[model samples]
Target: MSKISVLIVTYNYGRFLAECIDSVMAQDCGEELEILVVDDGSTDDTPKVVANFPQVNYIRQEHRGVSAARNTALKRATGDYLAFLDADDYWKPEKLRLQMAYLKEHPECKIVFTAYENFLESSVSAQEEWVKRCCQFAEHDIACLPTALFHRSILNQCGLFSEDLERGEDSEWTYQIWLQKIPRAYMEEKLYLRRLHGKNLTGSGAKQCKEQRKQFQKDIVHKSIRAVRRNNMEKNGISVLIPAWNAQKFIVECIESVKKQKFTELPVEIIVVDDGSEDDTAELAKQAGAVVCKAEHRGAAASRNTAITMAQYSWLFFLDADDRLTEGAFEALYAPIQKDGSLSAVFSYARDFYDLPGRSTNAGEEGKVRTYSGCLPGCSLIRKEVFRKVGPFDLQLKTGETVAWQLKFRNTGLPSCRIEYVTLERRIHENNTGRRMRGQEQMDYARILREHLRQKKKGE
Candidate 1:
């Protein structure tokens, strides 16, 4: 059996077939390689072209989609490693050599992909190289078939391409590969060459690819809903509410910390209100098992109120999208409530982490937790009845709603006390709205305090 199987699926690309096959023949790697060309009822000079190369194994089938053609080749492949080459694209001489070496050295990585250079059909020279992003899950990063060389075992886990999807079958299959957690390595060098030709634009595959991408996105959303439901089937107590705005970068880790909370006494449900985020914050939160709702651009107080209404349980714990709950946050908050049923609301200490030069207001040193008089709302767990009695947050305040509401709720004489135990880690980054509170935000804060003093004056 051959060590590597190079697969090429083509319908009617006779002009590019010989050149694509020649690139495989030109590979300088010292391994036994076999080239398989599967033709899907091409009326062109495809058979005559394959006849020119006696070494190439050519299979002729009825007009099936690219997915079906690739699946056919995948099942019949006899090699240990498989490399797919699109009919119009070819690879560099060192493409197979470098990928094989990397895979052998790193057994933990199941698949490896190389960067590709794109060229116009009229010109042979590639304009530039396609690059990978530094981020783990970049929105625009696309995985192409020619860039990857995979082991035969990956097919067992990821499965073959969808035979129905004509255009984006490869994309859908690649997405499944990522979902299966098959480790992959990306090479920075552009070892593959792609041709940008107009001939393939009018094909059936091209039309199906656009529609298939949307369908694949819907599948991901539905899958996320199912996953969240299955994982969070526990008796719930506290409803963790987060008001987020364009927090795509930090929301994943934030929700992950909440999901990792293993509370024996109080099971929690997370609810996130994405207040007009232009990014994927809502989707990421939902994917992380949080019940998500997207609404118009609103202040934090209003957003939190929306989540409070959607909340399923009694105890409500408010948190920011950029911050994280400590390891035993839910348990610590629940412990006090479990001890004292008369307590309407319980507040805990918070560990503030600062990324800027200055430290948090209460936190003395960087990377440490300290007791602050006015802790963030995330440090408090309040009974839903208490919030209802105190009334929803005042929309007049631009910022400092925590302090303003604390003053207002104090008049109601509800039993509330602060615990010594820290329950939340407040991340103070550049994105912190607290740090950027100025102009209208500052004015609104001053007005709340002024109104509080007026009410105190009347009592005195």
Candidate 2:
């Protein structure tokens, strides 16, 4: 049997806490229920009222705001499902019963919300447009967390409530749910009661309160827009290709970084091409849940070409086996692509780290941040079609294949951009091919540039 954890967060609403507890205690839903009351430094008789309900669990925290209070209870909650209710609000006896029934009927829905009506404590002047506009008693349906019952999996994927937001935290979380494309259903029947006393933040007639609310709503909208764009890029999907040659020690960590990306609808496909490694790079990559491909004793360029042929998505990200992606790398890179359709690729800065001798950790302490406008594939996300236009890496150059390929990429006259966000960690060590072959790298660069100029003059 599934259980529901009812979370009630209160500030100074002592007088109404008993009513909220009574409503939860009267729930007729068959599921086991656990009620948690998080008191956000209430100065009133809130603790005394909560003491009346011996079964209710009470937690006290210093005044950290509503989001913090809810998060406090969220950490302690043990139920499979979660429901939020304000201390100033009460629900109908059939509220949980009906919502649970809807969930039982629709197995696909991860969340279900019902309509609610607001009631004011005292009448206000008709001339006060702000109060009239803020407080409405009409029954309406909304994506409110307090009126919704959702599975615990939603938080695992969409993340927790933002502690920075004092108000509209519910709306912000709802936006995350939308970004994750979580299946949800709405019940039209008004089953929740919102008590809007003059002290209520949304119902207050104070000018300062009104201004803060307006600003918070605007910030929420901008955040929602960014999240929507990131979600769209996720829907398009990405194939992360890693070309490894004798990279057994670093392959697992590299693959783990891609797996840690917080994608919702579509998961990133990690393809690791083992370029005939003498070590166990192929076996380790396969163990890390990557699609491992074995190729003959060829260079990283040929391995990358092999992976490109196996790629299933239009978008591609090439990651070096020795390097890793930062936490927000995908969002930073792909959000721009979603916003600008003309962009063929997006690149960013990479934080450099030195590999110390005798240290097992391949990723040493980070040193300086450097931008890669040249050969580093770990710093960019490029469309698969761009390869078709620019052509693949030259097989002749072993030391500077990516540098040579980048010159070809520039010659196509395709649009690409560089963002300031640091999305990669480039490891600098003794074994680095570019660092070891400085003379050869310069020669390769000179040759690629000469060819690029010739092609440019031909086009003219």
Candidate 3:
């Protein structure tokens, strides 16, 4: 048996398969290495390309999914270590050599993954920091499949990949391996290059890709639900807390959105804290069947604290009265908590819909907006225990109050994860709170910045 088996699963990728195969062949390792290429019934010249590489052991199978092709390759692989490389991705010549040396040094690690740079056409750039922001990673997390190298023994223990999952199969497999107490090591080197082109599966259809990502997240949630059921853990209920001031125009829509969540198995309580709205906000929330907690003309910070104090569930989700939750938002928020009991909070993306000029563009691809650092208030779910330890939102501040609390939570060193799957639609109109209290907002923001600077100076 060879010491390393390089598995490449391809389907109609004739354009880039040769470069991938050549990278493996160029590895300078002295140990014997075998290349296993599984073709998923490609009608293109992919077979001819593989045939030209005389040393590559190639097999043609029916058009199964990537997971099936990878499993087929695993069955034929006869090596102590197995590494997956996509046909469109290639690794550096020293990738295998350096990873093998690291594995040799750390015998306890069952899986090892390295950082990778992304390429568009011929120009290479680091992977988007927003991607890392959405998903929490160690300093050296594997950015792509080509950077990952794992011992064959991990496969034996964690089982094969889920053939049903067309997207996020690798993430599911890795999460399962971690659940089995298999230690993983990260190499801080960019050892691979992942090509980004229109022909790639994820890049082909933007809407379809987004839907598939949501489906992948649903699978993750389902896995967590199963774990919670089997272990009989403390199945925490979720409190949908909405802090409203003068949101009479949109409070009903917000309450209705929460009531329409996909995951209704867990008990959900809607707590609407009204901060002395002169409008009909309190009446709207009460008529919509929410528990309305009336406060005497306080700001959003005070209203949020009031809702938290009245919350009965251990898990709390703050939803603005003018915002609406996407379908399955609660399920996606609670999934990580069910899977990993150690997590303190889970956040998702919040999209702003404003009629104002220059605000119409979607900020998703524009990288992390400095305006909303930490977690977006309207789209986050947090464990009640975290608030118990870190305390409540800063009622002293008139604006950016939620962000102030998020920063405090971050300072507490806890496991936090963000998924881009769930989204909250934030409606921005003329009567928005920020618009009404612009001066107060600026003042509060300046105060927060000054406090941050003071803290940094003290630490130094």
Best by TM-score: 3
Error of 1 at 33 (Å): 0.6
Question: Please, what are the lDDT tens digits per residue for candidate 3 over residues 68-179?
Answer: 9999999999989989999988989998888887677557666677667756644433356633332332222223445778888887677888898877777677656544
In candidate 2, what are the lDDT values of residues 1-460, reduced to their tens digit?
7899999999999988999999999999988999999999999999999998899999999999998998999999999989999998999999898888877765667888766776665543334454455543122112657899988888887787899876677777876766676766555467899876666534344444566457555877666666555655224578899999898888998999889877654458888878878999999998999877666666877778767655656578999998888787888888887789889888777777666586433343444444465258777788876775677778767666776777777777799998887778877667776877788778877887787789889989
User: Candidate 3, after superposition: displacement of residue 294 in Å?
Assistant: 55
Write the residue-wise lDDT of candidate 1 on 250-320 in tens digits. 88888888888887676677888888889999889888887776666767887887676556566788988
Note the Cα lDDT for every prediction shown: 0.74, 0.77, 0.74
Q: What is residue 421's positional error in candidate 3, in angstroms?
A: 41
Q: What's the count of clashing pairs in each model shown?
A: 0, 0, 0
Which candidate do you rate higher for TM-score, 1 or 3? 3
Alpha-carbon RMSD of each model: 14.6, 20.5, 20.3
RMSD of 1: 14.6
Residue pair clashes in candidate 2: none
Please give the range of 10 consecutive residues that has the lowest summed lDDT in model 1: 130-139
